[model samples]
Target: MEVELKLLLSPADNDKLLQHPLIAAHARAPVRTQQLSARYFDTPDLHLLRHGAGLRVRKIDGTWMQTMKAGGSVQSGLHRRNEWEGPVDRPWPRLGKLRKLIGDQQQWLDVLAADDLKARLEPLFVVAVERHTWDLDVDGNHIELVLDHGHIERHGRHVPINEVELELKDGDPASLFAFALRLQEQVPLRLSNTNKAERGYMLCRQTGTVPCRAQGLQLAPDATAADARLAILNNCLQHIQRNETAVIEGDDAETLHQMRVGVRRLRSALKLFEAAAPCPPALLEDIVWLGTELGAARDWDVLLASTLAHIQATPGGRSGVLDLQALALKAAHAKRSEAAQALLSQRYTRLLLTMGCWMQQPAPEGLEEPAQDFANRIMKRLHKKLLKRAQRMDESEPASIHRTRIAAKRARYALEFFHSLYGGKALRTYLKTLSSTQEQLGSHNDLVVADRLLRELNQQHDAAAATIQFARGYLQALQTSRTPDLGAIRAALHALRLP
Candidate 1:
């Protein structure tokens, strides 16, 4: 692969007016440069190739350009960049020809746009050099880097975060470290050595919200459909495991959210494969335990953050915002850090070990049922349990919504686990309803917890009760809104055709 250097500069750098502290100290710029290129290959179904490392995969359909790369390793935590190109109708047989067709293009760049129009953060940008690229799984996620240069195109995403450059190309560590130090002192910034993906994986795993993937393990039936299905399952498991670890370690909040996603994916996968590959009851119990624990932390975190943001955005709320925010921050950090550590302690280790052992055990046989028939049986059984749980909810009980929310989750998970076999428009429709139910309940639950935590924090910090009064009011309003949503959910649940 041919080599080139890359740098991420602030928009203010348009006049080359920016100065890094390290660069100023050294009388030189800390800007990074490297040589890199790649090419890609993939099946029509996007079966083998997906998105690049630490980047989100938008969908699974049509042609996805595989990436390959060879370049100077950068010192930063950045890994060599990989990419999954946009959708194409080209089939597997024509991949080489298609790649050759695009080989001579001059540039390639993908910019993830700002996530929100009015958000505080700047947009994120990712630039790539296209060359000989092959899409393959590395450590679970789809990876594509330079093989040979065909053409390079820069795609941009409008997101909330501003110019953050990840020197994914191989380069010098000293150079990267020097760059980081320079950036930190020169500007108000959150400098991260860890890429988004790794941190996210760790958070999920530590919190028990996601199942961790066991390394050095391989599934049988390599040539069969089971191999593909199993691979996805394991990927989800490992992602959750890593995310959980991150949470316990007090890594970034985004990591925790990603981990939650892994949990949901795994739960969904289990539901999808319920008939084709059923897990044991004991194993299911452990997975459920992991979900509840992680979900507790995740739910609270989201609720507090959102509510805090909501307050800050308002005029009256902003008047006493700093004081209230400081107290909220203190409480949030305490709960988050404490929860994280609790999940990673020896007790949690025992839980993980136990779950690992269970995964190693054999699952019940599929009883020779047709793949679809088997899948349906699993779905109906699981869905029935969800309905049973939902039925247990009582309007008189204070925690009734919370209990039913858990049921909604299980129902959604049941559908996800069986997606490979039972996945269809109908199943999707049912899951959509159940998912909305869970979200409504979850939002209410988050407000409750946030309110209590905010109040406690206020008392600890000697803040007046009136300052934190909004939290209580918010929680009550949330409850009232959810009451109707919950009813709608129950009605929709009855409309689902689980069988």
Candidate 2:
């Protein structure tokens, strides 16, 4: 297994990094520089990629080495993957050597033995870098820090790379992050999960930007609450960081929404595990602040795309629809820009470091209970709170219903986090019903928020007043048209038996 943390730096930061006092003070020997060229191989259809594996052969100095990396989890910037490497005499990959390591694993054997497998292997991309390596003893841990400057090339096209990898040679993995955080104070760095091979694969396939969804969690049956909480937090953080580029570089609404969802999920996890490992209030506030920044943009996007579209389709509402849409879109774009800037700010970087540090800390004493037991207690508590709020749904007040919606959402998120632990028809049914109820309540809440926003916009833009009035009326009508089926929601809530 190879464990390392990767951080990306701007090209300008490269020179400053070499002169930094920290680097000079910790160096055990003079920095060693070498040229490295690697060629990645895969089948025409990307068989290895689908199986979460990467194969590459590189020439360093005058020696050739082949490496195989597969199946691993990435949390923040840290990557822990199964890696096998050995020196070879030639430039071509020696797949048979890797095969020997796998023994008789049938699945792997079948893929390795596919007809023309060796023949089909083609050079996907070339990574050529000038690597600078330093061996440092940080707090008694042996750490190897390597800085690579080069490009990933494919068919004459290339993407520049200026990144640092801190591999743990010996001792605690936590030290890697600690060193990273300290180094971050002098140089701006972003946590990067995109490995060299992944960038090559993307370039080879000419892949475009796409929204990142949450990856499923795989937990053991006997995992403890602390274990589950850490896994859930890691999953949420990955979702947020994975979509960072798409959210900032591309104007993809879904990506922004997913990013916001990731933030919400992280906040929810913090609350869910509060009893076991309470997050600092300051950290919680920062998370909330970032979420609000993201939400401002996302809320407008929903109104412009969905709610406004619905209003435009209604009679008498189409008169000023175009004008209103133009104004809303302008505002939405501005908010998105603001949200993107927030992501790039130093505050956001510090927040990531804070959360990373918190994650490495030991769980509180009380969190050692089995996950199943913890899930049962937490689920029942959240469900009861949700039910109590639902009981007041008959009031039909916007504020009251909004509160219910929030409760439902929290309960639903809790269910989702623990669903894998207790999977059955009942859990599925409960989730389905909860989803339906949450959607209905969410729509109602959107109307309430939309009306308020329209009123505010109406005050600012005299030309949009008529359009805002029309929108408010349409939203009220829509809200009245679809009442939430509270009775059915209650029935589902009651039917759920805590596992």
Candidate 3:
């Protein structure tokens, strides 16, 4: 297995990194440059790629090498995967020998060993670059900092590749992220989840982005809090990064919403695992910043779409609703752009790197207990706290209701993290009701925000006053009509049962 962290930056910023003092400060050897070119191969239908594998033959230093990579997890910019590399007589894969490199990976071996697949394999894309590398040891951890400026060209479409790979040859995995965070202060780097092979395929196929949701964390039965914390946090990072491209390139409202969910999930995980999983205060503050940024866009989107539709349905309300809708959509678009740029900014990248580095910390003392036990204690306390908060819910006191809603949300997130560990009909029933209560609270909150937003617009732009007045009246009516049933929610809370 190989561990490495890859970062992307602009070609202009490339020189900024070349002169960064860290390079010379820790260099174990003089910087070396090489001209390299690699040709990726895939069957006509992309058999290997579809089966979670990639084959490439590269020429560097007048030597040819064949490599195969598959089955890896990418968390926040860090890559850990199995890699097999060896000399090849020419720039062509020698399947007979290379297939053996992926030993015990029977499924992958079978795909490569097929004679028909080999016959159909052909160069699909070419990646050519000028690579500069320095060998450095930070705290005794050996790292190869590689800077590649190149492009991947296929069928006349070229995708630029100006990136750095911090390949860890010998060191603790956390050290890699530690070095990355330090280097980030000097260079504006974006943590990349896509590998070169995958990038080539995307460029060649022009594959579109799709929204990503959190995947299941099937923790082992014997896993401890230490193991579970890392797994849960890694899942959150993947969820956030996966939706990143979708939110940027696609306008599907749901796509950006999912990305926001990813952010909230991470914050929730850190709180639930508390002692076992800790993050720097600065990082936590940045996460709160990110959530607010994403929330602004989401709010506008919902107001323009969901909320406006409801206003239109209100039996008898009128006055420039259409005009207000137009303005809301424009604001939503602007907010959406701002949100996308945040994802592309250096500050956002730094947030991920800092969090990733912090995540690598060793398990704190006293967290060595089994995950099941840890989860039981945390959930019990959380459930009790939520019940106490629920008992305070009051229609007259919207503040109290919001507090209860927040408690419900936190409790729900905690339950979700441990759902797989203790699955049963009882757990399902509780979670379903809890979700219902949280959503109900959210609907109430939305009306309150809508009213405030419309009033603000009315104060800012005189031309919008008439329409805003009508909108505010309609919003107030909606709020009055749906008085949140605190009794029902309290009933659900009192019946709380932990799985």
RMSD of each: 15.6, 2.2, 1.9
TM-score of every model versus the real structure: 0.48, 0.94, 0.95
lDDT against the true structure, per candidate, is: 0.47, 0.85, 0.86
* Count of steric clashes across candidates, in order: 102, 0, 0
| lDDT accuracy of residue 218 in candidate 3 | 82
lDDT of 3 by residue, 1-499 (tens): 8899989888999988899898889999999999899999999888888878889999877889999988888876689888999899988888877867777888777877766877899999999999999999899999999999999999888889999999999988788888887888878888989889999999877888887888977888999988888888888888888888887778888888988988999998888766745577889989998898898999988888888788777676575787888888888899999999999888898898888777777777777999999989988888888999999888887888888888888888778888888888988987897899889998998888887777767777799888888888878888999978889889878986777
lDDT of 3: 0.86
Show model 2 residue runs off by greater than 4 Å: 100-111, 394-396, 480-499
CA shift at 99, candidate 3, in angstroms? 2.0
State model 1's lDDT: 0.47
TM-score head-to-head 1 vs 2, winner: 2
Q: List residue ranges in candidate 1 displaced over 4 A.
A: 1-235, 242-251, 261-296, 335-354, 362-371, 388-396
When 2 and 3 are scored with lDDT, the better candidate is 3
Candidate 1 residue-wise lDDT, 1-499, digit = tens = 2122122233453222233333334332233333332122222222222223222222122333333322222211233443334343332222333245345432322112222311322212222322222232222322222222112221332111123442323433234334433343444332222333322333323333333432332333222335434554656666665565467654466667766676666667666666656756765776676666666566556755786676577565536666776666665576577657655544444333343333434444543444455446656776786677666666556487787776677666545544555546886788788878877777667666777666666677565577677656755665665554545566777778863
By lDDT, is 1 or 3 better?
3
Candidate 2: tens digits of C-alpha lDDT, residues 1-499: 7999888888898988888788788889999999999999998899889888898999876889998888887876679987878888888888888788767766666667877878888878999999999999888989999999999999899999999999999988888888888888898887777899999998988887789998777778999998999889998999899888888888999999999999988988889988768889888888999999999999899889888888777676566788898988998999999999988876687678778777877777888889989889998888888888877766357777777778877877888888888787878777787788788778877777788778878988997777788778878888788766667766766676654
Ranking by lDDT: 3, 2, 1
Which pairs of residues collide in candidate 3? none
